[model samples]
Target: MVSFIGMIKRNMLVYLKDRQAVIFSMITPIIVFVLYILFLRGTFVDALEKYLESAKGLIDEKDIDVFANMLLLSGVIGSSVITVSYSSLVTIVADRQAKIDYDISATPVTRVKIIVCYLIAAFINSFLISAILLTGGLIIVSLLGNTYLSFINVLALYGITLLGSLSATTILMILVLFFKTTNSAGAFQGLLCAAVGFIIGAYIPISQFITPIQTICNLFPGSHITALYRNVLLNGVIENMNSSMNGLDNGSLATTLKEVFSLNLNMFDNYIMVNGMLWYVIVIIIVALIAIAILFNKLYKRK
Candidate 1:
């Protein structure tokens, strides 16, 4: 146990030694947040009006803003997953390439501990990174004077994003343990961050996608985490509401006779808090198991 603790500390210290390590995981989110605020300004209302027109409804403008906020928050939380996954992968690959991983295995370390060390180090980094990003995001919202920020909501956002980061760690470990080459690891991480990270509506709003694409987007862990953020920050809860014709267009009788039936929207209620936490636990266990398995296999390697 002492050795395990020592290994975790050592790995964390080593990770801190790299300047880029801190920037990607820690600095990049803030940079993205600033960029988003700048780019989305003066256009949010225009965009909302367009979405309202497409919804084919007489819904309240505030309701539209509320829904839009949820989508944006989800993207914000998704960005954290990118940072956690890529930065950890890069460090793990670097350690292996330098033969430090083999050196550690030569000691009295067990396979479980070897993997645990990396996870511990990653978790510590995740906690700090998630906390900072969440706080910064809330601050940005508050500064805009257009949104509310409460402690409970902030904590929920943190929990959801942390789970996403934990789940993403599994992919990072799998890449590092098997790829074994630093260049391959770097390239793979780059592709994932581009394809799976910022583009997948994790950093951008998934609501931008049509229904079919949005359905597919739900599969990504980052999407769910971002949903949690929206529920907490914007809705103050996650509820599962059945599809209702509440927001449907109610035009003049002549228009109504046209029989332009509107699509039913499924309303997810305050159940987001419960379901989101459930997802967090499930993702954590599954990712932990995968990371453990990979670490054990690598630990016993004869090289």
Candidate 2:
């Protein structure tokens, strides 16, 4: 057990020591926030205002801002877990590039232990960074105005974040195993950061996309994870706004936004609820882990 922890510790150090990996891991998340403040925020607010056409006079503008920002917050947080996990896994690719993985595989520690250590370290590193992003998000939204994030809501997000991190770690591990050089991994992570916000409905609502594109994004677990975050982050605010409007045409807004944002997803021609999304992500993680185990045997030295 101690050796296991030590292996994990070594992985963590490799990730932490590479300042480029650490900074780039966070860079995409920061860009998401910055883009939201400068561009997307106004766009979202305007789009939401269009949705509020019937109840404009009845609803406070600040209420709209709260909802928009929370939506942004959820997306930003979601992107972080994915980007950070992929970033943490960069260490594995770096090891491969350096031929250090060959040395480790030759050790008596066993391949399963080595794989598990890398996964655990990535999960921990991603979750920690994701948690910090959540903290900053909550604080920023709170300072701006009323955020619906109660203590329980925050705790639930942490649990979801944990799952998101693990899913990302497992999935990225499979990708990492294919990388013979850090350059390949680096290039992929760059694209991941560039695309993740859009794919996860962080930048634009998936509903606005063409049917096939929307379907493709829904097939991804990260999009479903964002759905979970939306439910936790914005549900309360939706409920309150509904009450404030008092049937002022917003009674369906909850249901509408759920559809619009892919908060309640459709899978295989069947509608999926929040709980279904949870299970779906878990299933994806399991599948990814199984694949990783198989790949390690074939791709890495099985010694």
Candidate 3:
């Protein structure tokens, strides 16, 4: 246990000492947030307006703005949880490149202990950053002055962020060992930055795609996690809008909006609710952790 904790501390200190790696790990989500402010926010608002074309004056425009921001915020959190976790694990690749893993293997620490320490350190670091992003997002959205996020909702957001970080850590742990050098990991991070936005429906919503494409994206735990975010953050605003409209569209608009933004996914012809998505994410984490342990034995190749 002492050696495990020491390894964790050593890994964290080395990773944190490199400011550029830390910054670039978080850069993907920040870039997505910036893009929303510059371009996508207006497009979403217009889409909502188009949806409400019949009852143009019914929905509060401020609420629409708030709703749009909720989507952007959720997408940012979703992308960050994975990107940050992956970046945190990049330290493992660097250690391998430097033959540091060889030195560590000569110690009393078991291979499992070393690997667990790597995951634990990454999880801690990723969750801390994700929590910061969540707090900042809530603050920014609150500036619109009409958000409907309750204390319970805030707690749930934190809960989802926790699960998100864990899921990302275990999932990425299996993938990280495939790269024995920092350069390969760095290149993959770039691809991940570009792909995650689409995978989680940040760049374009999963709803806009065909059924098969939607299924492909939704297969990822990150996509379901993002769906969880959409429900928690946007459901409150949606309730407010429904009250304002007084069932004006007979709940059709709310349902349509949910589908449009992927507040829920119709998988296997069944709608997946919060509890269902939670289960899915939990299952993914379990499977990923098992895979990581097995892969470490097979592929970590400590030399």
Candidate 4:
């Protein structure tokens, strides 16, 4: 256990010492937040206005802005999880490229301990980065939208963000093991960082995509993580909207907005609830962890 902890500390120190790499890991999510504020925020508000026209007379305009900001914040958290976790793979690739793994292999440490140490370090770094992003997002949303989240909602967001970070880290660990060089891992990470937002519907609403594209997004845990985050973060806003427009047939509009923003997903001709999505993410994490253990064994034998 002591050796395992030492390995984790060593890996973390290596990752943290590279200031440029740490900043690069967080850049994509920060850019997405900036773009949403500058460009997409207005577009979403304009689009939502048409659907919310009936409630305009009843609801305050500021409330609508608050709801929109909450929705965007959820997407930002989703993007942060992927970017940070994927970027954490740099530590694993660095170990291989620097032949640090070989040095560790010559010691008394078991292969499983080394692999677990790397996983633990990655999880910690990714989770810490995600937590910072989530806090910043909430603060910005509160200031910009002139609203505050409930205490329970804040706790729930932290928990969900941690889970999302874990799932991303586990899956990436498996893929990172396949790369023998830092350059190849860096290349793939760049592509993933660029495209993950679209895949998880962070850059655009999932509903705007065609059926096939939507289906592909649904297959990944990232989309479900976004859906779960939105479900919690925007629940109050949605409820207020429903109450303000009571006795009105706004069910279709409400449902459409939820689907578009990834608060829900259509699965096998039926929409899955937030609980169902949470279970799906948990299952993915379990499967990915098992795969990682198996890959670790295979690589150890080769070493």
Candidate 5:
């Protein structure tokens, strides 16, 4: 166990020294988030207003605030998923290319220990990427004039992101173990991550896609993670609102915006938070175990 920890620590140290990797994992996510926000600012505001009226008095005066917070959190989670999968797969492939697996195999260390060390290292990378994205997101939000930040929401977002990122990384690790070749792992991981990103609405508005595609996407960890953010951010939607109805009847974006920005409380409670985070952890564990079994089989067959 101690040796495994040492291995993970060593990999982390190496990761810190890799400036290119650091930038790709940390900087790229924030940049992408900023760009995405800039491009979708209008749509976001419109959606926020429309959704606010749907909640009625159930949520008061906090639609814009909640929407902004949710957007930032979702960006952090999405970026972390990308960062973890990219780093974990690329690093493992590089190690395999260098024959590090055989070197470790020839040593006293067990394959299980080696795999655990890899996972730990990947988790560390994922965690750091998440932290950086969160901090960067907060700065962006602050600069954009959103002062009503909820630390509790931030904490929930972080927990969900961490689990989601780890889950995606674990799946990639399975691919690495199964394929063995650096080229195979790299190609598969890149393509899979891109596909998952689209399916999860990370890079595109995947939710706007057809129901069948969306249903298929739900099977992926990325989709679930993003859905958690969407649920929290867009919880208790206002549906629509008309001014003549005194905020009681739903009507349109303009009316909903007028009503939504006037609230002070959240539309949805903690239930969504509990469910979303629980789902990530449960799914991650199940996937990780299955991945380990697959890796063991591959290794056995190779031997």
Candidate 6:
């Protein structure tokens, strides 16, 4: 047990000491937030205005800014989870290419312990980075939208972020295990950073896509993670806005907005509730972690 802990500590130190890895891990989320503020924010706000105008006084224009910020903040958090997990993968791949794993294998460490160390370190790094991004996101939302997040909401955010990070880390660990060279892993990581936002519906609302495209996005675990985050982060603002519009049907507005923004995922003509999605992600994380451990054990025995 002590050796397991020591391995985790060593992996974390190696990862954290690399300046390039830390900075690159953050670049994707930073760019997404900047682009959303500069361009996409206005576009979403304008669409809300147009939609509300058609509603004929059913909704207020003042609420649009708050809603847009909430949506973008949710996307930013989602992007952070993917980027940070992949960044941790870079370290693992580096170690493998440098034959650090070979040296570790020569030691007394069990293969399962070594694999668990990597998984634990990846989860820790991903969760910590996601938490930092979430904090910055809440601050931006509060300052720009002039709204405060409730205590319950903050707790919910932390829970979802932790789960999302774990799920991402496990999935990336499995993917990285297949790569024999850092260059291949690095290339795949680059592609992932570029496409993950769109694949997870962070770049655009899932509802705007074709049915097939929406289906594809729904199949990805990150999309479900994004949905869970958006539901918690935006539900209050949406419900509050819905309440102010007295003539609107109770909960209708909130439901519609959630659907339009992909804050709720549709599966087989039914939307998966947030709790169900959380459980699904948890199951995936557990299964992936176990599978990777078994695979690594076999590889170690062969060696």
Model 5, position 281: C-alpha lDDT score: 52
Task: Give lDDT for model 4.
Answer: 0.80
Mind giving the per-residue lDDT tens digits that candidate 2 earns over 1-303?
888999999998888888877899887778888989799999988888887787767777888889898988888888999998998888888887888887898888888998899999999999998998898888988998888778999899999899999988898889889988877888888888989988888888877887778778888889888889989988988787778778766378767767776678765556678888889899999999999999998887843
Q: Write the per-residue lDDT of candidate 1 for residues 1-303, one digit (tens) a residue.
A: 787888788777766777776665644455455655676423444654553454444444544454444444455556666566567656667777888877877877776777778877876776666677667756755654445446676666677666666766665566566666778876765566556544444344554455566555555555555555554554431111111224243423212211111111112311133464456547655865776686658544645
Model 3 scores what on Cα lDDT?
0.88
lDDT of 6 by residue, 1-303 (tens): 888888898888777888888888777677778888689888788767765664656555556777888888788888888888878866767877887878888888877777878888988988997898889778867877645468998998998899889889888888888888888987887888888888787778887888878877887789899898888877777776777777456566667788888877877667788887888898888888788887777654524
Between candidates 2 and 4, the TM-score winner = 2
Task: Report, for every candidate in turn, its global Cα lDDT versus the true structure.
Answer: 0.56, 0.86, 0.88, 0.80, 0.58, 0.80
- Please give, for residues 115-199, the per-residue lDDT of candidate 5 as tens digits: 7777778777777777676667657656754444467766766776677767766766765665656577656645653454465
Clashing pairs in 4: none
How many clashes (backbone N, Cα, C below 3 Å) per candidate? Answer: 14, 0, 0, 0, 16, 0
Q: How far is candidate 2 from the true structure (C-alpha RMSD, Å)?
A: 1.5
lDDT tens string, model 4, 61-138? Answer: 877798778777777788888877777667877877888778888888888888888888888888887898789878
Between prediction 1 and prediction 4, the one with superior TM-score is 4
TM-score for each candidate, following the candidate numbering? 0.73, 0.96, 0.96, 0.94, 0.73, 0.93
Ranking by TM-score: 3, 2, 4, 6, 5, 1
Clashing pairs in 3: none
Candidate 5 or 2, higher TM-score = 2
Against the hidden true structure, what lDDT does model 2 obtain?
A: 0.86
Worst 10 residues of 6 by lDDT: 54-63
